[model samples]
Target: MKWVTYEAGAGERTGILDGETVRGLAPGTTLAGLLAAGALVEAGDDARRAPTEVLGTDDVRLLAPLPRPVSIRDGLCFLDHLRGCHRALGRDESLHPAWSENPGFYFANADAIVGPYDDVPVAPGSTMFDLELEVAAVVGTGGRDLDPRRAEEHIVGYTFYNDWTARDHQLRDMAQGIGMGKSKDSAITLGPALVTVDELEPFRRDGRLAFEVSASVGDRELTRGSLATMDWTFGELLAYVSRGADLTPGAVVGSGTVPGGCLLEHVDTPDLAAFTGWLQPGDVVSLRGEGLGETRQTVRPARPVIPLRDGA
Candidate 1:
């Protein structure tokens, strides 16, 4: 089932997207609440048996499936993306041996998430605005030190994630040998809907979801890749994440950028100002997957950046 959270009248509501209509669940129902209660599947079944209300597509405005997830962890599962990005940065193009030893990830801004159709503002002082096409799994059960073989049972569903980035800021911050910093905290988009694991059975190949994803900037198609190309599985990634930490419900685990999923991997240099294809205000960026839904966002001007230190 495709679950969604949308705006209705003066309040928010949760529903199941069935074809062109929406089968409304109880008022104030949220994906986060359902997952935290360990009743996502039960709630879905109940809604199917008796929908409280039904509305057409034009009746409601969709929001992120879980507007404020508990936490967000983005994993680097695809080696091609890393290799391509390394070459673009004038670094070694060969795969790093450390990358093969672990399914590593970085913590992201959970408060920065937006809906599928929301307008994303370019980061202030950023000239190289870019987007990373990814797939993320939402946790349904809380666990610690989870076994990789049984981690799949903790996942509730999958959703599309557009990990928007300020390329210039990211490069500068990472150059200091620290984290990626807040370069990606400006805006991260998720949803259209949260598709349950069972719903994706048709796309499963060799026990992995093998869906193809593509992204476009307005009329021009930028890149396309497959999720099955990931070197590590979601289970292994989640297992590593829960090594000594708690993997709680409503937490999101991203599968990182797919191979060739972002413009950073395709560009030769970090000089976006000299590049004509950089995203501009009013540009529409759309991403679509074979099974997961599409995420379409419009770029907007950035807000003024505040100085962090004493006046220079």
Candidate 2:
């Protein structure tokens, strides 16, 4: 079953997307609340019945499945991506042992989220703007020290994720042991629809998922890669993140950037060097994966952030 959220007169409201129509669900009940109640199955079952109201997809402006996630964790799980990046850069030993030994990830601001059809507000002073094509899983319930074997049970659904990056700030800040949250938080996208595991299980192998992810700018398809190429499975990623913390309901996790999914990984490639510069104002970007669907947005800078105090 596929779930969605969209703009309503009262504000964002939860609903189910069946074919060309969106059926509104219970009042004041957000998708997050359904997951927390461990009622996703029941909720979806009820939604299939005649809903409160039904509207065509074009009649409503779609928002992220969860407009504001409780937390966001993105991971680097693909090995081919790392190897390709190293080869392109003429470097050796780029594949560190720890990558295979343990899963690694970084925290992103949940508030960075924007709707699927909304314009992306680029962070100011971000010259190396890039987009990472990926898919994300939303947690259904809280779990601490989650067993990798059982992590799948906690996942509520999956959605397409566009992890917008300000590469300049990312590189500079991490060079000094700091995070680039200031830049990363400026742009992020999720949605189209949240497909439950049952609806997407056909794409799974063992515990890993395989999806053809593709991204395009305007009409040109610049990125294409397989999601199954990852070295770490989503189950492993969840277990690692839950080591000393909880994977709470409403929490979200990303599959990291897929191979060739972003410009940074192609930095030394001839094609990347010949590209028409970084993302500019008003460029339309589209990202799509197998069951996760697609999210397209036009680029725009978030209103200028002016500091009240002068720096030395």
Candidate 3:
């Protein structure tokens, strides 16, 4: 069943879409809630209760389907793209060899997420910006030291994510061997909707998922690839990531950017001109997969204004 966190008239709440009409669920609602309340079965029992009712595809304000992810872990799993980048930049791919042992990932601030339709703010004093199209999995059960073989059991579902990067800040941080610069204010965009594991399991085998991913900026198609192209499986990532840390329900784990996934792969100039030039204000980015629905967000300049001084 498809689930979503939405804001209609009242504040943000969870709901199941029935055609063009959305039936509200409780706040802090979860997949377990739907299963416990028998809502999932009810929705499935009748063909009419499908989530297509509350809003048409165009009308829904799709928030990140999982509102309160406990933690967000993102991994670098694209070998072909990584090798291409190393070759293009004339860097040593051997230094960052494909995971011979296990998966590796970094933590992302879950609260930093924004909705699909929200305007991404291009922060002031920023000239270099880039976008990354990625696939993210939501965790359902909490576990520790999880075996790679049982990793799939912890996943709740999957969603689309755009990991926006501030190149200037990122470079500065990278020079220092850190990632803080690439991971700051409004740096992540998620949602459109969340498709449950039950709805998407047919596309997976053992613990690896296979799905086609494609992205477009305005009228130009930028990237197209498949999840099968990934070097490490989600199970490997889960097992590696959860080694000592707790993997909680609602945690999000993203598969790093795909090949030609960002302008960085296609552009050759030193200033990254061709890359940042296309994402002018008002440009719309759309991402889609076979079972997971499409997510679109428009780029807009950060609003200009300053706060008044407290005793002025």
Best by TM-score: 1
Candidate 1 lDDT over residue span 1-312, tens digit each: 999998878578888998988888888788889888888878888888899888897888889988999999999998888888887777888875788899879999999989999999999988888999899998888899999899988888899999999988997888887887867899888898999898988988986888898888898887888778889999999999999999999999999999888878878665545665567899999999977888888999988878888792
TM-scores for every candidate against the unseen true structure: 0.96, 0.92, 0.84
Clash count, candidate 3: 12
In candidate 2, what are the lDDT values of residues 189-220, reduced to their tens digit?
A: 98988888888889887567776889887888
The predicted structure with the larger lDDT, 1 or 2, is 1
Runs of candidate 3 exceeding 4 Å displacement: 27-60, 87-90, 93-95, 182-185, 205-207, 270-278, 303-312
Model number with the top lDDT: 1
For model 3, how does the per-residue alpha-carbon lDDT over 1-312 read when each residue is reduced to its tens digit? 667777765567666655555665545555445544445546444424443234454454667776556678888777666665565455665644336566656777776788877778765445666678898887777789999888878776788878877655666777898665543445587777777788887888645677788888888888998888888877778888898988877678988888878756666654444454536678888887888777777888855535468664
Task: Give me the overall lDDT of model 3.
Answer: 0.70
Q: What local lDDT score does residue 195 receive in model 3, on the 0 to 100 scale?
A: 75
Evaluation by lDDT, superior candidate among 1 and 3: 1
Candidate order by decreasing TM-score: 1, 2, 3
- Candidate 1 lands at a TM-score of 0.96
